[model samples]
Target: MPDKFDTSLPPFDCLSDSQQQRLRDALDVAYFRAGETIIEADEACQQLYIIIKGSVEERAADGQEIFAHYTADDLFDVRAQLDARSRHHYQALEDTLCYLLPREHFIALYQSNSQFAAYFDGNLAQRQQLLDEAHQQQNLAEFILTKISDDNIQPCLIVPHDTNLTAVTQAMRDKRVDAALVKLNATPQYGIVTRTNLLHAVLLDSLPASTPVSQVATTPVISVNKGDFLFNAMLAMTRHKVKRVQVLDGDNVAGMLDLTQVLSLFSTHSHVLTLRIARAKTIDELALAAGSQHRLVETLFNNGIHTLFVMELIATVNEQIIEKAFQLVVPPEMHDRCCLIVMGSEGRGEQILKTDQDNALILQDGIDWPGCAQVMARLTQTLHQLGYPLCPGKVMVNNPQWVKPQSEWLHTLSDFVQAGTENAVMALAILADSHAVAGNRALLSPLQTHLHQLLADQELLLATFTRPALQFSVPLTLFGKLKTGKEGLDIKRGGIFPIVHGIRALALEHAIADNNTFARIDQLTRCRVLEPETASNLSEALKLFIKLRLRQQLGQQQDPQSRGMQQHLDISVLSRAERDLLRHSLHVVKKFKEWLGYHYQIRD
Candidate 1:
């Protein structure tokens, strides 16, 4: 219906003639001279412009420009059609004739023509996201100063260099900050303090409080200039995991940037809970902190942070929260008698999202527990409240079957290795990945020690573990094509799990205790357990798999009906790029499976 010269839009052959006629009738042609303003930045964009002739330049006020040259039916201002607040100014570069479809007309055409609407909906959604990011950047620019300036900040908690440990401790208590700056010459230099330093100096070393603060003060203080953005300061704190930062105005000490302040500025309520759990004294506070786990995972994933980092950071936080919870709930007398162990993905530090509780406990011999069962029940219940669902198979710490003494767990592993049944192998797979989340780390160490001993029998290890690694065949046939079925292969079973399981098998064979998937891959590569090419392929496959899952999880958040269906993420929502990555990843997985089959010499 509308054309100028060479450029042609994507074919609308699927649409009925009536739908095409509707779109044609709605389009309004307009002309602009060179240097004419098509749209202004920050203004509401009420119409979509498709250039029928000539070219235009889109520029931000800050001098960043993008050229959008079109001829004969090329979409120009699709972003304006989607986002009400267009962040860039559009100007004609030459004599331009364009068709303007007003919002009402566009929507009418969209409703009447399903195919036409689908084209706009998908592209418009992406363009709107870009606009929202631009808007966020603008907002961030406005808050830059307020975020940096230590206005409304508390004074730097200080103790004299000569002050006794007792005085320094009192100052820390009084200030409520974990650390105090030891001001030596009134000008800040070469003095620092923290709870960790206090614990090491006073408790572990049995030093007296009257001991000079200089003895405990960490020198070469990590300080940030006042002119720096709060984000930089937050990064510094996050990197160091320090509770306080010295705020400086050039050379002069201005104030202190406490973790609380930074957390308050950049974090949500759930993030605040993480800090609270770190400092929590009672079980109640720890439980409350644990409750925020689901929200924390959702927020972190949604914010576009690196998924691997998010998983590791979340796992770290989870371990801290779990430790604190145990400290709060478990009686002090039993602390030495028991150990809390995390199993499965939790232990591997690859918990991309919250799922069920997979934990176990190892109690010391000669420990009586009339209250132990009740305690575990309460613990699991608390975990359930904190967004972890109870293990459907009753694999949690609450189960008496899973909770046992160190000798018992070792014997169980020995039995599993000897029997080498499917169930026993599965149990071994889960136990092989176990890491101590709380309580006695020694209890879990024995399991690793025994596994290393068992792995010495290479034939048995391969027979038991390597079989599961080839359970799911990778879907190479789906490559470069849209997966039409509602049920694509479970990505976890088809791709992620096999790689993870295969890597675990290799790690066990090598006696590698590294639970991280990436770490395991690296370790295997270094030890010549796996070829460099295979390791690289596995790494890329894992990355692409996690990225796809995360993208799906994020998309689910936008759909109200699918809020809780994150585990059953829709693969159809994946972009063409994502689908390609997935296909390539699966091909790599298939290659890895073939390698495993040959190396393990499995007849199946």
Candidate 2:
């Protein structure tokens, strides 16, 4: 048992072998039966207690409430021991054994080891600093992998869908819940009603107090599956603009996930920054909000937020910027007449920062709106003001070629597939990734369906679409190292694009509707187009490419005079672990291209 606790290990590892032996020799194994008080409130703490088995609870003076718990391998009452007093009632939770280090021996260790001393004396910030350095020292950060389920303290409060607003509000208030899950017993249809929903319904919409909650609630509840990464839950909430998400346990409601819980867990600045963007009422205000974007990214990245979460958060913020811009220029009536869609990285929800604009307008057929061109111009100019460069190909809505009636878009898609011209095919590739950011999304869905139907049987076209994935050299030398240019390897041209474009092309062939690369890989795997291992490797490779690109881009940004470095990845600047990962990822990229070629019967 002592061997398992390993007194000579971290928070104690700095102690010399002799010191460890001295402590080990002084260690007295003590036992306490359940409910026995280990230390009373305000009593002097004469020993340092380390749990070897069972658990102990830190309780209030009356022992009615547990403030915290300590289990196996946990050290307790260090602050109290240092101050020579017990701060709370510490009682055994079960029959337990703990190693007791006498005050004299503990003082000797404290006087001897600075590393050991810093840990016990440190506050939250100092402890977090120690966690920040964990990656470099083979120590793991427990915070990074914290599961969402750990914070799900509120069992989901369920109410019948037919419950009136007055009753629902009273029920939520009585239960001390800010949200309620409205379940329909007849059809299994469940929806979410939050405090915000109630506000919008009663205050904004002026709905009657007797209105059923299900009528006011958000239908088709967006939820994060149980066991999903907590970051995924946060990301899902940000994208959907919801305050809470249902924690689903296989189609059953397991619990409720409040945004506050996630925010507390991360304590990140990005969420607040994103809210600023969402609240901006004018172009100047939005530009001010957008200016802090670089700082937000830098801060979150340094704090060890995963690249996937960071990218999604950034993309979501950009979407808010674009949506706000759309709202500024377009009237309420015109919103239903056209679908403003973004393609490329923004559409795929992978963009980390503002880049070139690749947007188009899908106008409803037979709509008489003379201000369409004017609105598109204002929208494009406003986005440019927000730091998005205009698309070089004039894909912006202001360009008449990119803005057309829904019928025209459907016909154009058909023509593009049949002609298979180079320019037409490039346009098709862009449209393949299009996602509606504002306006009537219904106008865009049918057009996407028409596109899929036109090329559903076109095998030759699929091969042609995938051929551009081989346009660039692999950027790896015959010696299996990254091939570098004067700047660095072309990260986007050689790695990111091929994987994205290749997967997108394959998706088109299979009629997979997902635009996100990771989602496409999962769908492809489920459909047996790729093996599970291959899919996982591809996903990992894509993430690595994205992380490298963002780092390289940010690095280039640090030098004010640098130019033409967007896709350039300086191999020399990468850490050993990063470089090794890059080498292996590029190998995976090469294999991927070869696999695509073999599968499509396209010779190299």
Candidate 3:
């Protein structure tokens, strides 16, 4: 054995110094020649093996089916070591050197270190979560990722509705707080008076100090739940362009969260980005803000924040950027008369990197705008210039087919549902996930109701809508190894689309209103449309697929010459645990696809 073993790898990296030394002291080295059997099928495994160099393969009892590949720095056969025997054969594909840790020592280490042991035990989701938590612990400000609690909330001053503005101001000053909550006798029941509101009321509006504080307070204040994520509170502040928000426990006020409180934890880049986007008077300035988004995503992801949180944050940021673009380009008078909606991944709020513009315009009925076409064309051009590429399928607002009056849009959806042609079904599927980003959001409600009603009991149409999800193979071989092409695997088609489309079909069948896949999965579980375990597996699997694909996409984007090359999952570079997770995740996908096929009664 080498004088020092590498303790930097996962599972091992989680071990304490004493645990590492104990493991190292018990380690022994072994070598196997090419084509030699390291461990025969059904034979007792005396020790755990960690490859130092070269490659090995695990095969079935018959030695004809390959199950997995383990390469340099890959650890293997934890199951075999624990069970004392495995119904699989291990053979060296090339000359191999490995360090062996005796079964007794390994078991002792496993018992001593729960984290190290969890790496070997638990389901894929638990294992991935443990890894994520381990990663997050490395970042000092990851507390921002935690939910809002008493630790982050501050006590707020509450004044009666009849309290004068001067009294409220004095109360705020005495409490050393920037805002105070006012008790209202009306429907909202509560309103907030900030220093800004007080200033505007007294100076700008020239109101008297003796006026009731309720008159100066803003009603229906923007607030976040006490149980909501601190990051979400920041998102609310970014979205509404406010510095402070009330924290609520049920219907009652808990405390207040200020922008300064959040900034004090860590100087945030997302807030700066949103502020820039909000203040951008020209498209060029918005483009600059848009350009920095990818770097921000990279920073958050690398800092070990949860992937879902990152997605939610990016989705909100993207929405704000798009909304700002809309306000800058469209005529102010037409804003309330129309709604802007994004479809596909953008609509689902799952998009990370900039992709094609899949958007449309829903105008109010009987409204006439002479230069409407030109305005939409300009908006599309501005988005393209802001880093969002144009849709090759022409799904953007620039295309007149996608921009229409609400009445005509509902009619179009009805026609599509009734026709049930392949193209029509595909179109309906796309529109099912549409989300309004700008303009009057209420305008799309009628369309949502109409579409849901049209397909209320249309079993045949639902099945047809679900058929495309199973059209692509799951990219797994019979023995459960990943299948890849010369360009690597197109995870988008092989894994992501199947899960997304399958979930969408289920949601549509049950009229689940959530557009995001993760939300849809939870709602489906609550409705018992999917078993709890299956729903959990599917959610975890989809997260893995998206994470891997995002890594590949980012890698491709970083390479200048790789532009225009289709992004694919490069399996050769994955660690053994990741590859194992990928296989297990794909198995989850395969099982989901089978369930989809049977549930929908889909036939060849």
Candidate 4:
């Protein structure tokens, strides 16, 4: 009756009530005083023990401590107890009470419940397979369970290539469809004609209504397989920046899937948020729309949308938000004289969650708007109210030092590369990832071109730039174990920063213009600056690290106390597969850092 034999832990939690009852009946309560040996190294483990109300410490075969802490509700001797022997010893660190289930009963439960059995029986390799399954499950977006074929696709409205535009319009009106697929010349190749295309041709180009349907259509249409997951269709649409995708059944054209139709299945956020931002007539309306952005992110992440896709989509929306804010705060006449740029992650289009505002304004030479400072301050404040916290580093357009003329920006870039001070290196690093988000991007173009010229073949400068990549020790120990500190490993510091900054430096050295970390990795490989295998490995490592950081970040918001905790990750909270992944990814970080030091010839 003491807590009814807690079976709430894993493996046991998966058991049926009857199985649980059997466990409850068989469970024997046992006690151990402080320093008492519950199980000795190299001895047979008789019973699987669950710490009901005390702490137990585990030691390796050689008496070196490993993961020594197990508290209430924790289970021990899972692997070793199953095998009837263990190489490690477990001792009670204080007065302890444990619910012990005999090995035979555990085997019985294991025999009946495969999932429960598998959890206990799995070796490291099998656990890795479980991890793959877990990741694959996470990869499946909510919409992915439905295939394109499962949706009620409108029938294809097939028309001949030579059919007149008048007939095409009539056919579309009759079918009540916005788009039609054109069957061209008996070949599988097809074209697409939408209402917009027709309108564009007739009104702008002044084509007669009698013009051939083919003339109005876009040639070589994009399509999604009927059997592909609905999520894939969404990804296709996002990647192509299109509003619709053609559905195909092998060589035959099926029909078109409008973005509206597809998005209606899920949250309004997928499409409506962007639509609202585009149509919003006032800054107030845009602010209201921005409120739903975090919900959208949570939905996307919970449903397992890949981080990069979320990054791209969110960046687009955030840019629109910034653009709208700029329009609200700036006069139309002044827009042409200045370029607005987002630096750091925002500039790279890799920003997922809201972070500090890192923006600047580049005014044309000899151009200054009279109330520029106040206007920029208002813009930064608006973004903050919309959830973009102001940059602690003061790298915002509101800072006069950051808001400079294009000529000054040029001089500053030259100074940074030549001076090579820590501040200079940091400034150039930020600019290297900078992207013009609003206003005239061309005004900022010349500065980038000049900066590239300065960066080319500057070895000492390159080494200085790459030096930060080697700043943090990779969190993996020499034997490939995750080395945790009191606050846990700083995953961002030890993993993400190395990959992001290392690739950024190499990109600057090789004069690669891509700012996205993933794209930089690929470009480096394609240019043979980094080997394909190395690039591929580092890419996986970076993505996994990003995923973990994002999860921790998202997790923190749910609990206020968690937000106060350092970004250091306690690996104990991670599952076997996640721990393995982190361990492996940290190893990748180690190798990448070693290569960076070797490439730059850095030493202690």
Candidate 5:
């Protein structure tokens, strides 16, 4: 029967109806008792097995080690089927039932279906890319990816600089638009006059109707290119606090994009959310704005924006929120005397959801600000109020140890390098990713330069710094089965931290300046520290890990009682594609860890 076999799994799912029918027609159910060897080493493999029930293990030739385990819904022996021989012995872990697709029919289908063939033939990165492409096709939202063009822009109502407010108002009304473009006669610059500008000019200032609109128009009109993302246009409008933004095609004015139009497509009001953060005059106002960030993140993700883009955008928002809080607490006179820094994930700009605060402050040498500690503590409290969780290690601005003058900061780093203890090395590693968020950012440069110089050629310290990356196992069985826990899988510990820290360690060794993992990987590849193929796989693996963790984090947030389940990915609930991806990504992680161990010469 056609329904007897399921064609829903990937690779097979990609096959055509006729091809699937032929496969089903050739399919046969086979059984193996426990302790039986299904295929012997060097045997000529005649069929590809799709496990229908129970479990099987592919062992090394001597049967001393297992390569992989296959359970129900898992397929096996693709390599053997393609090569026409088994390199290893396959044994039934339990009484096993499997669907057998004979080799000749499988080869005919593999030779015919390029898409199906690519999955088995491609590397890890390429396989994940194939899955991502399929996922995007099924889930990508069109509106968020919309580009600015004439189709969405309103016709510009252009008027001369000398045009009277009354005439401009009438022109705007006739054009059925709320804003007019004032082309200055004296210069090539264009100014914008909105209905609010007209009303203020007449009602608030008591200007005569005959007054030139140019007097009230805002010069150097805010604009976005016609080729820019519609989402960016929305950001511009929010960041600038304008209802309409001028659209330009190169140097020429294209038209205008009204707030209402963008809101029509993006009902999330992300512009309004950003505007609230931008204009927050008090900590309470800022906190209210911060509360909406998670919702915005969910909306953007649900709209199918890439996670990297989301991280970059969210990092910008987070920095702004922090900078605003700092300015509110620290006196204006002290602003230039010190720089506020964020370390760890915040420093690297990979954080998508709000996590613990990992901030520090770097002071200008000999700045007399006795109240600095109190001000920093207030800033930290303000951030906490705004939804940033406190760092468990107290690695924040409020900690006296993290706040220091430039000269003292250099000394502290030198001391850390000299001490070379595990804790000190870890501290140095965290500071390696420091990014200045506010104030005299220059204060951090000399300190960073000193830290790098001290670390230069310090192989022992670097190895010790890298040693922690191997602290946690990859949570996969030797035979490629997922290793779970009471709280499911701790993806951050198992997958994300190793990749992030391993990349960080290599970056430090190569003296690469970028803090973001993806950027560091690119630089490492460019410097030949990492092979291009290895870099590509690491990048893909890290992306998958972060995306999966974010999914679980969002799920945890939705269920408050599950807050204790943070960062633990429940494997039982994963989709087939996600499970496949997770398993493949973990294998990449395992290999990278081995590479790190070899590079650092650290044995387990």
Candidate 6:
């Protein structure tokens, strides 16, 4: 043990008196000249160092360096000591002295103090994350190679009992001189001999290579479906300890799935869906394939895919589902006669989760039969069966009030716009987001034109419609801390709905036709209806609100009792960071509300 270790270092300040003295007695002071290499990359570390005075340059294996300057108190080599792997190079940049603590002794010291142990544990975790990123960059090919589908490869190289060796050998040579799959029928059911098997047959067993490939062919094939994700394929490969997996289309073998080739695709959800859609034959098949929408959303969220791109992808999938459903249900003659219009969130293309159906039909005026209502009723029922629930307020195809002829829709919009009553204003606000989902899209154009013409006079509509956006206040009290208790802040009322309504109000004022939240925000910003910073904040707030709602819906899906109650659970589960973000978002909504209240001259 060395005597007189310096306790002036900042890290040593946290230690208790007895602990400090123990560390001081055990530490060995080492001196290093400037430009000396303290630690070499890929060399194991056996000790921790507390900097007495020094600066070091840390470099990667590729020679990229970062200057890590340390004064009299900083700790260095903690990661090296914890990981026990020398994956980084550290060189002294200045003349320095450090107190070295052997790894075993320092670990023993940590075992006695929970706080000290936690501090090191946190540092170790951060270091591991950095190391993992570095390793991922270096060994990308190996990472890809591990993800090959299991279904493409056979379990063993064996042919059927009756097949001749000459045919098997010829088949193997034709397929690039390795192995051939043997099966009783046309489908691959077993595996046959390779070059290694031929050698074993001729040398070890004294049997000729031409004796019978079937005699040497292995039995049973290792297989996996094409739908399996890359990570799942990698896991299967690791578990089975096999290099190749056979790819199956359904019940039949489609092709060989080499681990190396499958891993190269980086098989994203969009890529998978594209492949699935390309091969799809009928409307019913497309509808079935659209079931992967939820997985696609989850994947996009996990992979940090762009928020706008995510919305666009979801919108495309929703359109495909609706289009396919309509194709399956509607008569070919009626297809040209009627149009499907989506309203509310679906029309806005901001729907992140499956919600209630809000749609209507716009049919041509000349073809109204008594059976039109029944046809629409069946269509609504089919949509409900496809996971979209009926709107509790009857804002769907089943509602005769919502479905009407193009001429009737125009007349209704003209009346509502001219009336300008509170009810008319409310109706117009909902109708503003109406978009064509299928059929004659031209039918919606006239209604949009009429609505915009009416909205040109902002004073009348702003006074009545704009008040809803300012209905809820941010839950901040006099002291500036968030007000919370038994029930959490109503995120929808206080944060999300307000921002959405405010943005929509601006869009309407400018006659900006874009309905998606992000797109509308961009349009509003460009028209000088909103500041750029405000638009960005509102977009972020909407994303957080949507994410929270999706999580709540997923939770409700897991529990039968919770399904009926659409409310999210208590907010205690949110991390400190999440709560902070929520507060910041709500503050933004509050500012927008104040702006709306002032602009509309509302007394409340």
Highest lDDT: give the candidate number: 3
How good is model 4 by TM-score? Answer: 0.71
* Model 2 lowest lDDT segment of ten: 132-141
What local distance difference test score does each model get? 0.70, 0.80, 0.87, 0.79, 0.85, 0.67
Residue range with the least summed lDDT across 10 consecutive positions in model 4: 123-132
State the lDDT of candidate 3 residue by residue for 512-543, as single tens digits. Answer: 88899999999999999999888988899889
Residue-by-residue lDDT tens digits, candidate 6, 1-604: 4455655332344478888888877788888899999888888888887666776666775666442344354566777776787677777889988878888878777778655665456332232222223222323323333433443443333356566666666656665646556664545465645677766777898875457566676656567776664445543443343445566668766556545554464444354554454455665566567667777777555544434555665776676577667767787778888899888888898876677899988888888567888888888987886678899878898899888888898888878867878788767777878888777778788778877777778676666777778777666554333455455556667667788787777778778888877888999888887887777777777776676666676556657676454433345665333454555566667778888888778777
lDDT of 4 by residue, 27-53 (tens): 888999999999988888878888778
Residue 305 of model 2: what lDDT? Answer: 62
Query: Of the pair 3 and 6, which is ahead by TM-score?
Result: 3
Q: What is the lDDT of residue 487 in candidate 6?
A: 51
User: How do these models rank on TM-score, best leading?
Assistant: 3, 5, 2, 4, 1, 6
Worst 10 residues of 5 by lDDT: 132-141
Question: What is the lDDT, from 0 to 100, of the residue 425 in candidate 5?
Answer: 91
Question: By the TM-score metric, which is better: model 4 or model 5?
Answer: 5
Which parts of model 5 are misplaced by more than 4 Å?
1-4, 16-26, 133-140, 144-265, 558-561
The estimated TM-scores of all candidates read 0.62, 0.73, 0.93, 0.71, 0.83, 0.56
List candidate 2 segments past 4 Å from native.
1-144, 161-173, 191-221
For 90-170, candidate 2 gives per-residue lDDT tens digits of: 889899899998887888899888866876665332332333343322211234455667455358789998899999889
Of models 4 and 5, which has the larger lDDT? 5
**Backbone clash total, candidate 4:** 0
Q: Please write out the lDDT profile of model 5 over residues 1-604, one tens digit for every residue.
A: 3357888667777799998888889998999999898999999999998888999998999879887787877887989889999999999999999999899988999999998899889877777766665555322356657899878988889999999988999888998888889998766699988898899989999999999988998978889999888878877776566788899898889999989988888777677777787788888988888898898888777665667767877877787788888887789998999999998889999988888999999888877888888988988898888888889999988899999988888889999999999889989988999999889988888877787788779888888899899999998998878889998988888999999999999888888888899999999999999999899988888888888788778877877677667878888877566787788889889999999999998877
Better of 2 and 3 by lDDT: 3
Instruction: Report how far off residue 34 is in candidate 6 (Å).
Output: 52
Task: Please list the Cα RMSD from the true structure of every candidate, rounded to 1 decimal place.
Answer: 14.2, 17.8, 2.4, 6.2, 4.5, 18.2
Candidate 1, residue 19: the lDDT equals 58
